[model samples]
Target: MKHILNTLIIGSLIAATASSCTAKFEDINSEPYRPGDLSADDYALGSAMNNLAGCVVSSDVNTAQFTDCLMGGPLGGYFADSNANWKATISFFNATDDWTRVFLKSDKVLPVLFSNLSVVEVVSQNTSNPVPLAIAQIIKVAAMHRVADTYGPIPYSKIGADGSITTPYDSEEMVYNKFFEELNSAIAVLNEHPNDRLTATADYIYQGDIQKWIRFANSLKLRLAMRIVNAAPDKAREMAEAAVDPQFGGVIEQNADNAAWTYFSGSVNNPLFVAKEYNHEGSKTGGDTHVAADIIAYMNGYDDPRREKYFVKSEWTGIDYVGMRRSAKVPELKTIGRKYSGINLSPNSPLYWMNAAEVSFLRAEAEAVYGFNMGGEAKTFYENGIRLSFEQWQADGVDEYLAKETKKSISYVDPNEGINSYDKELTNITVKWDESATPEQKQERIIIQKWIANWLLGNEAWADYRRTGYPHLLPATEEGNKSGGVVDSNRGARRMPYPVAEYNDNAENIEYAVNTYLGGRDDMSRDLWWAKKK
Candidate 1:
């Protein structure tokens, strides 16, 4: 949403490389290529993004395994690392950078094109369609947000122009502001022109529905606004205020308007789909990661029946649940296209990307932060968050999950709590959940729930855990990851390092940027500027 624009100003370099994509070149027999219109090959940009986004989130889920990795196999069942599972790959000890390159490419290229991704935006020019432009704008903003949020200050505004590898990076603060402006512009354009044709075509997501796009724009904006409250309170408050303002509107009221890309089963089972598909056929893969203990406790505490549907307890695991250390050796499974050891609800199955649940929770968070909120938004989001997560998983007894949250843990965040105020808030969440949970228990619930909602989404959960140190995720034991996969953060790992290739080639500039934004590129313990404690 609005956050996308701020990232755009940071200038993420366009990602042109792809597995199937060929180098763009001029044909000797063809007329000289013009620079104005994007080449026919440019379409691959979108194609690549669809793949990368799926992979990125899939990787994210694998890591968090709020489903299988941390909870499914490990804690729930006597842990077993099936061939298709991500337990070995994501065990707390084994974080890796294998997926960063592709993810960054998707994050960057889409944003570059979106900035000026000319989908014939001109009305009278006979080619202008605000719909595609808006979608592109939205995606671009979304893409850049992903890159910037994860990598810290990246090459944003100055990225496109072919300068030396030493291109300077922008500050996270500056990058965020640009995203706000970009979303604001997109919203304004969609409202004014409303391109149905191009939107129908370019809107690969929601099929050119302007209203849905609008909600996505607003919801995304709210998320961005909430993200920066710690770093830029005044700015964050303004963005949040604008989001709730009736005139400006807010996010989706229900799950129907979820902004997500659906994956096909066979060749296009999306990343997770394909990954599962191939793994099922005997792939060299890790076992399903188990759900985190805190999450299990919370759901179980609330008697959240969704547990069965959301996760499959390994029949093999005789323990309450078995969890593999990131360092644990994963069983090899030979497979072809895809495989499946764990279970993921279908795209049409509900809980996907950023949705009403998250937006509601975000609003609740914003209200809690502001201290003036009646918690109307918070309660709605909280209830919706819990209910939707269960329903999305096709959890068994629907009425119970819905009826479970009667005892709200509002008092957990007292200033007297042992830890930070944020910890207190999270405690209330668990406190609200547990039959006899303390304030600490309640806080864990909030962080755990947030983590649950963030499953298969992005690194936001990891980042949140680091920033707040809530939910108390267990560190990968010695049996988990023997060698650290990616850089580590205080709570876990901070922002991942820029790819080795980027650092190798663009050493000077990357060094400068990293030092400024994250203190040190190799120092995983360093918090991002925005994430650091005052």
Candidate 2:
């Protein structure tokens, strides 16, 4: 993508950090260790922004494959593994090194590219200017939230401070509190300079549009606030209200206002596209990217119009759309791969960081859950989410689709399975909203729709599933988790354990974090503070 140049800037910074200092020298860290004037420029800020956006939408890198794609995509029931190696982890819930990849890229690269000291220096240099600093803070919050959400706790406020090389982990509460504070600071600054911007030349997402940045900040706040609904309802309500509060800035309401990162064709293409189209090693076939059976069953049952754009027909079975079972083995997956639908792997696909459909669904959940004001009734917002999702994909027949109230998720039947392949009927969840449904039923309906609307965004779906336990997903295969009887196969994975490297150098900190926030164990079965079901 054209944004490849932006990533190269951050890549060079990572290389510089790796080769700058020798392992045996502590006294040789003075001149060459310092960033030049170019590192503190607005272009650097642009590079940092690009880097954060890229990670948030990561699907290609090893770190992202484990954290975002493997943990998220499969757990959320969006995709299934093609290789037996990956399938073992996905189906049996085994702990692997793949889960550690996200932190490696994030810790070793991003924070350094936009160092905290450099950002503070830039802010001090531009005392009369708040746009640059505000933008930097928003990017920081965007990047850090993914890390904090994946693991229970992280080094947030003091990551790059002097003498904080091996920073201690803050509790999840502290990290979220800091996120709110930073977002508040950014929103206040953005409000002060409503339309002003320092630079947009390097911005690949919104082109230096400060107004869009403000909207994105508020939208993010809404997301973070909703994440804590089970653990901190009062705080969630307070922040959710503020997100829609006209006194500050309003939440994202239009598809045109969505925050999506664009990509250039060729070598700088979207990683997800490359993985799907090219002969990635883990995939079953050279060009097979199978969708999950649950999604296909639900979409096909609802007569979804977006399926045409979301998936391609199977060349083997000659079926219009067929999704693979989540626990299928390599041989079955290989044959089924020939008949299963592949995702839209066009190099031109945009990576949506946040979208209006998500905002609408969030508002719907807020209204349905607590009767919070969201411009109108929860049903209206819910329907709008469906409409906007269709519009975003440029699909038609939404009005006709929305009008049907009898459509429900159909029972799944593996096309390649014979008499017994663990085919189960899904929850009879329907697309249309029922006015007289119970609160719990309404909540389930809302979340199920949200899950359907949010295609390719597996992390958010996984979080919501863990939080709400809606869109009732299939259980792990009979293989079960390889946790030595630690992880409950019925419960599924709650949060990823910290990287093994964190334990090597910062064992005390990791121990403290696990004991403080994770109930004295650094295991995958333990839920994060916010993920505990009410």
Candidate 3:
């Protein structure tokens, strides 16, 4: 393979430490050399693939804690940081550059993805098989779209084009278009080579199962389609319909076909597990991360069985599954937050990319809200989503769970501090799908169930919260609104601002992005192109 030396600039941005990969590849812990330096025979496709996989949601403990736990998890209402020091950060709608920048920076998502993709492109060109490149494209869209969603305009279409640091930013709308184009191209290529196993040993998500990859791509397409429904309804309907069409291969509809990054050995641990269950010394403690009040309230009210699978009972309250309130005082966070329920996960737990349960809910939303042909009725898909979620977690009581019509999210009471408690029931939406309900109500039901099913995938949950405004999340407590009036306490942050590094490194392009595409300010208060209007 002809190595491209120019891409090393991007690689330099990524940490040189070895990534935690699946044990099937014995050399998984070998340090990642610059992508441009690898020769044809020396190229480690498995390592590159693993690195790409890890960067999607980040298998690294610190990266995951920062991007997911501190930022997306709190904003998405799935988690809250138990660390009192973080009260002024993204968890409370204050977008600190240090906290919010991780999602955009080298350690987590973009630089590593683009670098590996460049190497994969060269490999595809030298070899006749197109499988690896197709798979790489799918991974790129999966990872980069999250970056785009987090920050409105990003260096998408132009990254690594000529190895320039000052790549132009693409508008969120344009970025979504490029995502569709890439997914379409990838789906076409994979469909042609349905039996290809060129990257089988290197594939961590699906083991180079071409058919499964195709399904994942379609499911990703459906997700992107639903994301843009409010922003671009016509295009969203067209893409959503195309995604589920059998002729173009099908979306993930079975639990067996779920897409996730798996770690075979204990040395390479799941990030969420590490963040919530174990301390830095690998000893068990009241972890720095805890389940958020919003999710626990919703689940507790419905008596959801998945709570047992998703979180452990609070240490202070022994029997109750308490969660930390985002707006709690620093003293409460230091004392009560640590006692709140931590995530119920093990070191080897696989981090999900997408699952059948989420797909079923997406189809439900498409059918119920958009009136699209999803091969089933909206209520059927909605209930199926709940059922699949129960099965995914090995939780029982599905029949009774789905039959309940009156159970709704209950009020949150901070046992330690009554002032922090929210006594009024937040949402009236129930578990059972109501066919007679309006389209908006049905959408709420679909998204609420979807949010519940997407337990640890906080980034997706945050995006859904922005897109549909369902599962009414509690605002950060008055003390937690540290945005200096840039963000509303009630509405929360709309999107993360561009990292300061972007402004320092690529001033011209960043300026243009803010001026032309991002409404003249790189502020978290600004809504993304796909977000529901305030």
RMSD of each: 9.9, 6.9, 4.0
Tens-digit lDDT string for candidate 3 (1-534): 134542442243222423332232343433444434554422456666776777788876787878788778888998876665554578666656787887677444665676666656655665666788888889888988888888888887877722344688888899999999999999999999887885434677887788999999999999999999888989999999999999999999899999998754647677777677533222122456778889999999899999999987776654468777775564334445545676788777889999999999999999998888888999889999999999999999999999998885487876565656888878888888788999988988889889999999999999998888878888877687777788887777789887888888999999999999877988888888889633
List the candidate 3 regions with Cα displacement exceeding 4 Å: 1-43, 161-165, 277-285, 316-319, 331-338
lDDT per residue for candidate 1 within 254-296, as digits (tens), equals 7678777553322233334333333344332223332333344
Query: Of the pair 1 and 3, which is ahead by lDDT?
Result: 3
Clashing pairs in model 2, backbone N/Cα/C closer than 3 A:
1-264, 1-268, 63-101
Can you give the TM-score per candidate against the true fold? 0.70, 0.87, 0.91
Scored by Cα lDDT, where does model 2 land?
0.68
> How do the candidates rank by lDDT, highest first?
3, 2, 1
Candidate 3, backbone clash total: 1
Model 3: what TM-score?
Answer: 0.91
Q: After superposition, how far is residue 123 of candidate 2 from its true place, in Å?
A: 6.8
Task: Give candidate 2 regions above 4 Å deviation.
Answer: 1-42, 85-91, 104-128, 161-165, 278-289, 316-318, 332-334, 418-420
Residue-level lDDT for 408 in candidate 2: 50
lDDT of 2 by residue, 1-534 (tens): 534543454455434433211111122112333334234344444443444445456524444455545567777778765554453364455656544435533443344434532533343354456676677677677766776777778776666622132578888888899999999999998998887865443356777787888899999999999999889888998888998887787988888889876645444555566555444343333342467766777788788889998877656554577676554343344444566667765766877778899999999998988777666789999999999999999999999887777875465655665421445656766777888888788888888888888888877888898889878776655554566676665567777777677777788987888888788987678888899876
Using TM-score as the measure, the top candidate is 3
Query: What shift in Å separates residue 477 of candidate 3 from its native position after superposition?
Result: 1.3
